[model samples]
Structures are given as C-alpha cells and as structure tokens.
Target: MTLRSEFGREGNVWLMPGGSLLSAALAAALVVVGWDVVQLASEEALARAAKEIGPTGRLVLIADTQGRLPDPRAALAGRPRPFVVAVGAGGAFSTLADVVERRVAAAVLDADRPFADLVAALDSLLRSTPVAHDANRLVARLRQREDEARRFFGLTPREQHVLGALIAGRSAAEIAVANQVSMPTVRSHIRAVLTKLGVSSQLAAVALAHRSCREPTLLERMREVHQL
Candidate 1:
C-alpha cells in the first residue's frame, strides 16, 4: 500500500484504500475530528505500514472489510492497535463475531451508513478509554489459547494449514488449487487434520477450532459501536 496522505501529528488514523471516494470522504471526516490520517492504497503498502508502525502514540485503522486488507492482527502481532472494520449490514454479525473471537478489530461499523456515522463511532471510541490496553490483554489470551490448541491437537504445519482452510470454508478442490497440490494430497492433509483434531467431519473440526478460545474479551472502549 502507498501512503496517500499524511499530517504532522502524534496520532494516526489509517484508511486501507484511500483512492475511492468513500475512503476519501472518511479520511476527511477523520481529519475533521482531529485525527491525522494516513491513507494506504494497496495491500503492499498496508503490509509495509503495519510492520513499520512502532509501539508508541495512538494508532487507529479503518478497513473497508477484513478481506480487502492484510491481516492486521497478525501483522501487528504484539503491537495491538485498534481497528475499525466496515462490513455490510447483512454480514456484520458473522464478520464481527469472528473479529471479536480473533481479537482482530476493536470496532465494527455499518458500511451502508454515511461517513458521519463512522466518524461518530470513532469519536466515541477515542474518548472512552485506552483501547490498546484491553486489546493487548485480549490478544495475549487468544495467543495462549491458540498455542494450547496447537499443542493438544499435535497437528503438523500442513495439517494446520488444512484446518485453517476448512475454517475459511474452502473446498478440498479449492485448497488443492491454492496449495498447488493434487486433490489426493489435499485430501490426505484434510484427513490428517481431522484425525488430529478428533473430528469426524470438516464442520466439526472448524467448530472445535472456534471453540478453542472461550469468552474472548471485546475491547471495552468499543462496546457501544457495533453489537454482535
């Protein structure tokens, strides 16, 4: 991603893709609300920025959707910055539910709404509390749960990848294509994951993976933004 805009300020508000009119409008709205905006244009730029931001100052990222940008949660890893995800009304619950469970995004907003609504949400989030503190605690717990699950399952790297694909709703054929492997090889990996996870079906395996983390903490400052 390329940096499309910048302002001399301690805090930063990042827009994943700033070229679109909607993103531009949101960036302007954030600036109006006293947030110095850094608009990222592409996935590369987003990835670069995610790694470059240090663990100081206030940082908030606004992503149109999880799919449009790189995994900020993974990229930020130990940094634990706050994220605002804009998802469609129909898919908001499912998407935000996953975000909450993964501790990826601190807030969710309706993409169908006007930019003003998002600005209002951000304003509330910025004023409530320090989101990074809660986010860091939540993420640390998530990591522990994930590590425990990995150890208990004893899944190899390939098997873990297969399980992740299953959780993502990828068909065996799609997984094979993505991994550049034969259908039979992909099936073998799937079988290995199922065996290690002690599940009879892919759905069961996915459910078990989701069950690994119980009671993931939602960022306190964003409780009023989007209810899942």
Candidate 2:
C-alpha cells in the first residue's frame, strides 16, 4: 500500500494508513458541504427576516470596509417608506458614526453575533415607543411642509407635472422627450417652474420640490379639498 504524509505543525508530517487517505478525502468533502450548508442557511434566515420585517423597514449590514452611508434624506425618498437599521461590529459602527449621530431607526452590534440576535433587535426597534413617535412626527412635519409648499408655489397642473419630473432628477431633454414636447417648450416650463418656486437653479428647485412633494395622506387630501 502506498503511504501518504499529512502536513501538520511546523516540520511535522504524519504518515497515514492508505485506507485513511480515502477517509481524509471524505472528511474534506464533508467539511466543504457543511460550510456550503451553513452559508445557504444564513442567507435563508436573512431573507425570512427581511420578509417578516416587511417593506416598511430595511436592515443594512455595515462593515469596516464600507465607506459611507448615503444621506437618509436622499436615500429614503420614495414609496414603502422604510426605516433603516444598521448592523455591524463595533468598528463598523464607528465607521457609521455620523449615521448613528443622526439617530437612525436602529443599530445593532454584529461581531461574533447570532442571526437570531439581529432579528430580535429589529423586532425591538420596531416596537420601541421612541421610534414610532419620531416616525409619526416626521410624517406630520412632511405633510405640513407639503401643504405649505403647494400653497406658496401656486403651480398650475402642467407646472406640477413638470415639477414632479424635475424632482425625479430628469434632464430638461429627457423631460421634453417623455412629455412629448419640444426642448424650447420644456425649457420655458422649467423656467416658469423655477420662477414660481422662487429658485434660480434646477438643483435648488428640485431640493425644494422634494421637501414638499410627499404623497398626501387621506386626511391631508380631505383638508386640501376643504372636506375636513
């Protein structure tokens, strides 16, 4: 039988029985399969957690290598209105110091942590009174600002549509094409929007528009039509 040596500690090689070689190969294969199973299970757990959390929130895994989180104002702009939770090691948390300072919805330390711990943390965050209060206050303020903006700008229906496109970061040319209008007409509408909003630049106009264009709640709509 051919003898094979297994490398161990420095300058140490142990000779194994020829039968043991086959066993070793089987063990290696088992280890690889076990690792793959663990990875798949982790992914599935995270997926289930995300699904349970629903679209109203998100969990962001932060790492030391991650440079910076996007501005929440810009990042949280659209529908589903998800709250953000940051999870990572202490060093990772330090990297997101600014985000923490801004009081993100939640933060959980992840170094050597269990997956269950993360889900529990998320659940706790969702149940926290302070988090709910802050969210409600934010929504109320956004609605108030939207009301003020609509009243102050006094934009016509066409101008409102143009403004929406502009806020979506559409270029004048793209807006023209999308609206099936000439470049000159688009530019004219853009200028009119800027003038009405009292902003000189497109960026400023877009910024102001974003500050004001939240989807109106039913109560807000009722108030708008004076039915409330």
Residue 134, model 2, lDDT: 49
Per-prediction TM-score: 0.44, 0.31
Q: lDDT tens string, model 1, 1-228? A: 223334434256666566666667777766666667777766567657765555442344344544342246555656536545533231233444456556556655444333467678766665555454464455455455455345324776677667666666789999999989999999999888777766789888766655451211211112222332
Q: Which candidate's TM-score is highest?
A: 1
Residue 124, model 1: lDDT of: 66
Q: Judge candidate 2 against the unseen true structure and give its global Cα lDDT, from 0 to 1.
A: 0.44
Tell me each candidate's RMSD, in Å, in order: 14.2, 20.5
Clashes of 1: 2
**What lDDT tens digits, residue by residue, belong to model 2 across residues 1-228?**
112224321111111111232223322332332211011112234343433434544334333324333333333334343455443332232334445555553443332233344445534553443244344454345345545456434766677677667655679999989989999998888888788877799898766644443333322332343331
lDDT of each: 0.56, 0.44
- Give, for candidate 1, the lowest lDDT window spanning 10 residues: 213-222
The residue ranges of model 1 lying beyond 4 angstroms of the native Cα positions read 1-10, 56-70, 78-91, 131-228
